[model samples]
Target chain A: MVKLLRSDFRRLWRSKLFYLGITAVAASVAFGLINNVHYKRIMLNLEIPIDNILFLGTLVIGFAIAIFTSFFVGTEYSDGTMRSKVVVGHNRSMIYLSHFLTTTFAAVFMMVIGTAVIVVVGIPWMGSFVTSCTILLPQILCCLLSIVALNAMILLLAMLIPSKAICAIVCLVLVMVMTNMISPTLWSKLEADPIIPEMSYTDSEGVVHTQPEQPNPHYATGTTRTILQLCYDMLPTAQMYQYGYDKIPKNIHLFPLYSVLFIGVLSTVGACAFRRRDLK
Target chain B: MEYVLTTSALSKKYRNFEALKDMTMHIPKGSIYGFVGRNGAGKTTLIRVICGLQEPTSGEYTLYGISNKDRRIAKSRHRMGAVVETPSIYLDMTAEDNLKQQALVLGLPSYERIPEILKLVGLENTGKKKARHFSLGMKQRLGIAVALIGNPDFIVLDEPINGLDPQGIVEVRELILKLNHEHGITVLISSHILGELSKLATHYGFIEKGHVVKEISAAELEAVCRRCIKVEVSDTKALIRVLDRMKKDYEVISDTQANIYGVVVLSELVLALAEEKCDLLASHEQDENLETYFINLVGGGENG
Candidate 1:
């Protein structure tokens, strides 16, 4: 397994796709920092803070991880190099585990580089974290775990799907859907308060009227709310949103556990399926 | 003779389709074993199972006396290498980098053999050229070079020459021969290209419908696939009478043609045929080749 890791990492360093991903991550973070500075000055209403920009790398790092994981593992299947590894006596379990380890390292490396760029540039532009740095450690750790869990799922798809093109397409589509639609939808529904607070408003007249509090129809209620909250907590992307944008997710303390469980479960399933899979 | 690889009732089934069923064969040490089969005839499937890319649905196989079920089979697999379907190479890396990656996989301590293997595969001067831009033949040779890195004594090549031009085919063919002869490596080549296989294989395993139809050495197959003289004459009756008088084994396939097996004294037979009023229009030697033998064994069809 160590040998396989060495080989895979060697290849990973040489892979153009991997480097391209790193570049994208670094640039995205750098651009986000620079854009924040511009937005702060241009839009006075935009309350952009260093805390918001602190883990901003977490949001876009998943995209880089997705592309790199797809091509990295997908190439093994597409180029049939994975078969060569097996042919030369490497155990399938070792091979699959090696891939998981190697890609995880790359994912972490990309995320770190993105974070470093943010830290280096973010402080100068938006000032230091308003919240205590140590107080933000839990969210920071959750962001890292979510990044890993997201990579684990993408790696799972890339390993199982043999066609490089198909695997790549599927991974990119999955990441886009999760980040754009599913995570945001879940966050909104989970964040909505069940009871609408009393509203005092002036509507087309100079007289103030107070509206009675009532059940918020859009808020997920009862069992549905429980399931939706669980999903929001479990999904790495949703967790990333909570960490990067939310002040502190209500489930901040439990997100890492969910991410770890997600990682453990997905890695086991991926390795087992990969071990039994037939290569052509 | 000792064998490098052996299988007993090994079967591989994918859902309802059986790629290999009770398939059994042997690859002798230091011999070029040609695995001949038609498309979808389980040639690649058998290779995949033995190479450990896929598990057998039932039955078992062995490498160098180590059973597939044994934990030590991986150690046995260390003595072998394979290039299944296409050349298993990272297209993004240069030829040298690819070999280095393979060496890392094998846990080899040095890159000392990289140059030698590249030279052997005739890719010594292809520096910094990524495999993706290499020609098909070059990629195939690079694959072989990668396999040759660990200095394994046995190698498996699945359809190694499937897409090569004539020149490319000859280059790969020569490489395989050199690997087996100079390095004394045993080669198990799975290919439907019988003509090409015939030129290289010292032993042959004919597979059909996931079954090993037969396993015979090249010499033994030569004796089995008899050489014959196909004669097209005006009167096969006269030809038959002359042949029978000469006590030759023959078969008359058509009204005007006959295949006289074994040796025939041409001038003496012509005189005898002339006396019998048999005018020989055409005569040619038909040495039953691998393709012919394969067709005859499995029955001729679109597969042939």
Candidate 2:
């Protein structure tokens, strides 16, 4: 298993996808930081919260990691390297796990590089955490955990699906959908929470009046709201949405626990499926 | 005789299709075993099963005397390598990097021998060139190079030269021979091109419809396929007597047809047969090649 990991890591280092993903993540974070600095300088209302920047950056980083995982793991099937490893007597479980771990490492590497860019530029432009350091630290950790879980999901899909194009398309679509669905803003919209206008309108008679928007009757309620909340807590993307939007869950540590559980389940299932798969 | 690998009653089925059924074969140590079968006749299926690319639905096989169920079988597989159907190589990697990856998979201490392996496969000069840019033959050779990383004692190649040009085929053929003869490695090579296999095989296994119809050593096949004179004679009883008296090996095909194994003087045989009241109706010499022998053994047709 160690040998397989070593070999896989070596390949990952040389992979263009890995570097491309890293570059993309770095560039995205740098761009976000520069744009935030420009907005701050121009006196725009944009609040560049460090936590929000990091968590929101995951949206782009997650997709990059998805592309990386798909091609990285998909090539095992496409190039027939999976069979070659088996032929050399490496355990199938080991091969599957090594790929998963290496993909996870690649994701973490990209995240770290992206975070570095944020810290370098974000501290100067946006200042430190908007919330307390204790709260911010845990939220950041949860955000990382969420990204790792997302990486596992992507790796699982890539390893299980044999066709490269199909795997990439499916992973990208699934990630995008999951991320979009998990966003707090989307949930808020769905819930139809009343919005209070920031600026009040003045009538022609010089009378000032403010009106709060009514809630949509179609918004989720009762059991549906509870279910969506549960899903939000369980899903890594939903957790990212919570952190990015400053709606940190009370028990944020559970996010990492959920991520760990997901990794365990996905790895076990992926390894078993891969073991029984017939390589052409 | 020591056998490197053997399968007993091995079978594999996919949904409604049975790729292999009750197939049993033995590959002797230090011998080039030619696996002969038509398209979709379970040649690749068998190779995949042995290489652990697929599991057998029933029965079992032993590699280096270790059963498939035994944990030690993985250790035993370390001494084996294979190029099933096509070469399993990373098109994005250079030849050296590919071998290095294989070496790493095998837990080799270092890539000290990668240079030698590349040179052995005639890819030493393919520096920094990704395998995707290589010709089919070069890719195939790189696949072989990957298989040769650990200096395995046994190698299984499924249709190794299926689509190669004459030069590529010769290179692969000579490589097989060198691996078998000079390095004393056991090879299980399957191919539809019987002519090429004949040049390298020390033993042959003919598979038809997922069953091994026959398995014979090269010498035995040679003897069976030797040049012979087919003669139609009247009074086989008289011909047998004359043949026995002349001390020549012969197979009686029917009441009046017999095949003489070696040379025979026509006049002397005719005179001898005449003395015995036997009449020679017709005579012709026939020499059978490997392809004809396989076709005859398995019954000639594309389906076989």
Error of 1 at A148 (Å): 0.7
Candidate no. 1 TM-score: 0.89
Taking all chains together, the TM-score of candidate 2 against the true structure is: 0.91
Candidate 2, residue A126: how far the Cα is off, in Å: 3.1
Name the top lDDT candidate: 1
Q: How far is A129's C-alpha from truth in model 1 (Å)?
A: 3.4
User: Which stretches of candidate 1 lie above 4 Å from their native place?
Assistant: A45-48, A198-211, B226-263, B266-286, B302-304
Q: Tens-digit lDDT track for model 2 on A1-280?
A: 9999988999998998889899999998788668766766567866656766665567677788779999998998889888888987889888888888898889888888888888887887778777788877776777778888888888888878999999999998988888775465546754465443355789999999876565556577788777766676777777766665545665576788888887788788888888888887
Every candidate's CA RMSD: 4.8, 3.6
List pairs with backbone clashes in candidate 2: none
